[model samples]
Target: MNTKQSRIRRSRKTRAKIAAVKAIRLSINRTNSHIYAQIISADGGTVMTSVSSNDKEMRAQLPNGGNVGAATVVGKRLAEKAKGLGIEKVAFEAAREGGLVF
Candidate 1:
């Protein structure tokens, strides 16, 4: 199988396992120009909080959204939001091919 398909398959399996656990999901999506993160409810029906490098505040601070520095900022913001919502645990979900480094 090709790389893209393999990555998708891996991600699907990971998500399935996470669903079985019924834990809050910390999902990360990355693009060439931005990085996005969201914390989903335990039932996976609602997004409790989200942060992105493309956000207005982030964009104002960083000229480029697709960089390690931007990723750090996004991660910090996501953590702060999650803490405010009292989310202490989560199952991370990210594509295998280009997952978040931290």
Candidate 2:
């Protein structure tokens, strides 16, 4: 009905599909002030790893957390963490104005 509700509905559908396949997911959340990313377990019960522009290391290198540059850094960091954990594949889940994108 409302925008938020619609978004949630879409996300639920996407997540359901991902869960059905039992695939690890790389989820991303963006705010006006920061970008956050995480690797989630197949069951979606655990967060394997996470990275954000607000992290101490990122904050030190980036004067502003709300920008494409900061988002890139966060993405790179998340990728590194995933690789270190032996994660080679993931379903990408990112929020977009239209809906959640995979």
Highest-lDDT candidate: 1
Q: In model 2, what lDDT does residue 85 have?
A: 85
Judge candidate 2 against the unseen true structure and give its global Cα lDDT, from 0 to 1.
0.81
Taking all chains together, each candidate's TM-score versus the true structure is: 0.88, 0.86
Q: 28, model 1: CA deviation in Å?
A: 0.7
Model 2 — which ten-residue stretch has the worst lDDT?
93-102
Q: What are the per-residue Cα lDDT tens digits for candidate 1 across 6-40?
A: 99999899989889989888888889999998988
Ten residues in sequence with the least summed lDDT for candidate 1: 93-102
Error of 1 at 77 (Å): 0.6
Model 1 residue 5 CA deviation (Å) reads 1.2
Question: In model 2, which runs have C-alpha deviations exceeding 4 angstroms?
Answer: 93-102
